[model samples]
Target: MSTPELHWFKSSFSSSSEPGDCVEVARTPAMIHVRDSKTPGTSHVTVASATWESFLAYVTE
Candidate 1:
């Protein structure tokens, strides 16, 4: 499938200079898109907005 058109946000904590790991994210009306920031041109995964928010909240807790 073609990549969806949406606004993506790169984490401030991400190191764009050099990296073994990095994450990129985007938001849709009902979902969140995430993928390796280092290889954004590759693949991305989508999750429900509520699940995404819950995961973030849990991680921050």
Candidate 2:
């Protein structure tokens, strides 16, 4: 099977004023993908949607 293409985007909080210092994110139905804008080729992390949501809630709280 082949993986579907993902559309990655920088965080809204990420300003053009800072170069290569932001997080990029992409998503699928079941997983959230996260990577560093500075090193897109190095490595990345994938987490469950629920885990990602919980993380966001905790951080925002």
Give residue 58's lDDT in candidate 2 (0 to 100).
90
Question: In model 1, what lDDT does residue 23 have?
Answer: 77
Summarize candidate 2's per-residue lDDT along 1-61 as a digit string, tens digits: 9999888999765668878789999999999999989998878899999999998889778
Question: How far off is model 1, as Cα RMSD?
Answer: 3.3
Cα deviation at 52, candidate 1, in Å, is 0.4
Q: What lDDT score goes with residue 39 in model 1?
A: 83
- Which one wins on TM-score? 2
Model 2: which ten-residue window has the lowest total lDDT? 11-20
Residues 15-50, model 1: lDDT tens digits = 767765667788878998898866878888989999
Off by over 4 Å in 2: 13-17
Note each model's CA RMSD in angstroms.
Answer: 3.3, 1.6
Give one clash count per candidate, in the order shown: 0, 0
